[model samples]
Target: MKQYTIGKKAAVIVLHQLCMILMVTGVFATGYAFRHDAHENIDIYTLISLAGLVGSFVSLAYMANVAGRKSEDDYTIYYLPIDKVYSDVMLVIFTLLMVFMGKVISGVKNQHFDYASLIMTAGTFTFLFDMAFIILYQSIVRKIKGNILCTHSLMYKGYELLKRVIEKKDIHTQKTKEIMRIQEALEAISEGALDTTLNVNEFHGQQKKVAEAVNHIRQGLMSSVNESLKNEKLKADLITNVSHDIKTPLTSIVNYVDLLKRENLENENAKYYIHVLEEKSQRLKQLTEDLVETSKITSGNVKLNMQKLDLVELLYQTGGEFNERFESRNLTIVTKIPSEQIFIYADGRQLYRSIENLYTNAAKYALENTRVYVELEKADTKAVFTIKNVSKNELDIVSNGNVDLTERFVRGERSRTTEGSGLGLSIAKNLTHLMGGKFEIKVDGDLFIATITYNII
Candidate 1:
């Protein structure tokens, strides 16, 4: 089939070339006959030449269509700089032939029928046919070798450059989206969402490395948090078990101490020893209870019984209960309770415990003969309770320079000379939080202020 197709194209091309040659020969012959006044000989040659020219034109159209179909290779011929130079040389040659033909035709205008005129005319016609055939052949080549032309042309190069630019832009856009996803993942991680992770498979090159790094950080954070939580649970469990174990033996000791006290011993030294045992045992009991309570609060084991309570009544009651202790220390209680009732939602027992801890803290630390100020009032949507007292010791010693007092076992006095456990503030802070309130402590020089705030109902 391929051989047959090639044979067919060759036949058409041969026929076209023959027709062109015939047209050129006939035209020259007719022109020559006309110049010599041979009108009778012109008719048949003129008709033949015209028919051949028409046939050549039809063949040219068919060849052009064939060239168009094979346009994929049209640009292949002009890939090199030498090809351009060759085309320029051909154009110059064609121009020279045209000038030569013009001169020959002018020379033959007034000449007689002879070999000189015949040769000149034949040469001119041959050159004209050659020029026309070269132009037509080059046009067909341009169409058939389109790929080569496109590869070399400036417009084709510009198109390729534009395509590359668009591809680069698309890559950049994909990278930007990956960066944004990584940023969002990082932000979520920062906000304590440890479960957030980056998809490493969705990225490539340096972006994939970044995604892997982010995922590594997230896993590390999750592992660390899990380890920390495990340690916290173990610590809380230890405290709970120890407190329970001590309670059993502590109960027996308390019962024996009570029995010894009721024995009515007459010796003064025996009485003094019993009194010391009772006091130490009580202190130990309080410490044990504080440890257990702190463990429960930290481990989230405590349950709150939330209720609406009047702040004015609660504060007044707390003040009354601690009034005697304050008086004994020569510390006067200065109350600033609002007459209007301020209601807040909280666990009543927890709130009372928190308040009691604060009062105990004040009675233990407040300076002698100084006025302890207590205030309860409504502040916008919240109920604010504040207590201020002058410290018995330097505020620096109590606060320890920017140390958080709410931390477990943190204390006002570093020397361990105080009577109560250091968990009072910690317990109060935890209980306040459990009840959905805010607890704050401020020490200004010799003045210590503690504030509790809760949203009002």
Candidate 2:
């Protein structure tokens, strides 16, 4: 099959159709000669040739099928291994039937099933059977390499699925039954399933080890998760206390800066120092507040007051509030909101923050003098709030792909002068999840799109 080029594959198909024509004509000619009783010294060469011709047709059909069933130019992509095997088996059966028919026709044309006809039938079956095995073996062997490479074998596939559930931090939902079952098993173990032991009866030998390892890994993962969660709580407590601790002294500095500004200082440089000190102190204060807020939001410290709210009205309000900021950058807000008021179940305050972060993010980073698009779309049960804009800085795919972007302090740029603590998107993402919504971020060329999808009420 590999020897056959694209043109050859097509040519083989055409040749198979020609063989069918010859087989039909041979059957009719043999029939006509038998009726006239002019079959004396009958030549059986044509009958044998027709058998070989049908065999060739079957072979060509099998080759054409294996190559063209997938994306035409590629051999690596196969739909199903079992289906291919079944087809090969069927082709062999059909070729054998054709050869048997030729033998039967010869026996009938010549008087009785004599020694020659018997020899011909046995010879045809023996030769064709060997050919059948070779063809079937080749078809199955080709699939073995690809299937093994993808870890699709029973044991390998199960092992790989378990490894993923154990190693990956965020457990994603899967749609496949086998993987999904394994995922659920991991969850059961993580959630303190006392029977972490896999049934040794169900799996044998090394496969049993894989199941045991999955259970072992799950136990270890649960322990790690519990410890990390404790540490996280302690860290959140520390951040909250530290922020409060610094706030008291930071408040004193602000007061002193304010007092110094009111006093008549003879030195202009001294007054200038006070102004700079005030700005730095204020920025630190803002950073502390953002940190404490993000920690609370992410760690489930913040209580969500979920309620039904008009999404359209919220968008309008958020847009209107940022009108001045957008105007400062000479950026226009292009809205594609639905005409009617669309309501959804969510924490109004949190949803406002999420929408505000997206809008403000676009307004700040969007190319100056360009338009920022805010569209509200609903399909089936989900409602989408999408905002797209051209970034002011170069949007690197490597950075975007590697970084979660929703993780705390994971900024796109290394520079601190970008006017954000980089907690904006993180906060928005967490808040959305807290309110039972999905958030997605995509970067293409200079365009940045952030979409938040939630169940429509």
Candidate 3:
């Protein structure tokens, strides 16, 4: 389809040009024949020849106009037409007429007949030739306009490649303004001074002025965005640090308050209230700290500092920390960790916190008299840590895993009724991620399991 359109446009342009050239030559030939009067009884042939030339030139003008339209529509600019039938016909007709006009003109000039009629005929033919050339010129001008429009379209579509070119123009404009301003300032300073001698005061004033002018526009845009994130991150880190730091003292205070209330120094129910206050206070402090830490990890402020450590040793130590709570509720703590160490690179302290949170969650929410299983194993390049305990019932929906648990004041449906900060797993998740590990939860039947894994770096 493209080839055909191209060929057609080329044919029109070539034939038009050829017809124009022939028409011009025929005009000259007709003038010469009319002058010489070479043929007798040539008036009819001369008139026909003149008409044929006029016709061919008119066709040429029409064809050129079509070529301009096609070029405007981007039909073709590279192909040439092959047909020369119209051009050949015009050439033959004009050649014969030129011969007849020459004979007639020569005869009239040599006194075979009066030249008045030939003169009038020549005037008419000249007028037709001028009209044809005018139309041909208009067509060329239209084609030029078409070419320019097409070139503009091509440049507009190539925006990406020429993007820098436009930007440079804008940059140049800005620079020109700056240069003008500087030049004005310099002129003012020079005018104020009588001599070319440099003055320290003026020099300092100019330097300060330039500095003030060239200051960053509202600081670096990228830096401003980065700082906002850092500020948010700093606030979160502060909350976590403050919460965790205060928890130990707050827990001790709660314990002491309960001890005082239980000694019967006041109303009997006072002891119960003190216990409740202690429980609630401890939960709040722990939760605040956990949420802060969670924010820090999620916001990408925390970095992993993994070190090779024994999985078996870590799990055992973490489980032992929850021994008192388990014993108090007649719950059994089961271990599936091998005696041999499973070494993996992870932040030991953070990993410890993760384990402790898992165990604490189990002890707080697991069914009474049920066994809690803790397992640690090395699989490929990762160390998998699993803590599972029997739940009271199947939860309607699984927990939103670590994210919701980490949110400030958020709690699980069934476990909100129990004693908890609701930030344990959230903290655990943060710690796991900090150690370059992943944390996840799964529930099967009546068992709720929290798992964390670290790559064996």
- The most accurate candidate by lDDT is 1
Report the C-alpha lDDT of model 3 over 1-457, residue by residue, as the tens digit: 2233557755654554444434544444455566677555355545655665676576555555455344444644432222112333333555666676567545544553334564455445544544444443444444354453333333444765477766555545544545455555456444642122222233344554563443332134336667887898777767767767777787788778767765765675876777787777776665665666666766776666667888788777777788999989878988888788678787777777778778877877788998988887888887888888887654434644443444444554454564566667777776776677899877665677788887765
TM-score of model 3 (CA atoms): 0.43
lDDT (Cα atoms) of all candidates against the true structure: 0.79, 0.71, 0.61
Best by TM-score: 1
Q: Give the runs in model 3 whose Cα sits over 4 Å from its true position.
A: 1-266, 291-305, 393-410
- RMSD for each of the candidates: 21.6, 12.5, 14.4
lDDT of 2 by residue, 150-169 (tens): 34344555777788885573
Residue 348 shift from truth in candidate 1, angstroms: 0.8
lDDT of 1 at 198: 79
* Cα lDDT tens digits for candidate 1, 1-457: 1122446656677777667666766777787777779889788879878987998888877665554342433323332233353343445665777787668656665566574566456655665665465454655355345545435445667778888986565445777778878998999999999999877999988999999999999999999999999999999999999999999999899889999999989999999999999988888899999999999999999999899899889888888899889989999988889898888999888999999999998998899999989988777898889999988877544545787778887776655553778899999999999899999998777788999999999
For every model in order, what is the number of clashing pairs?
10, 0, 17
Model 1 local distance difference test score: 0.79
Candidate 1's TM-score reads 0.61
lDDT of 2: 0.71
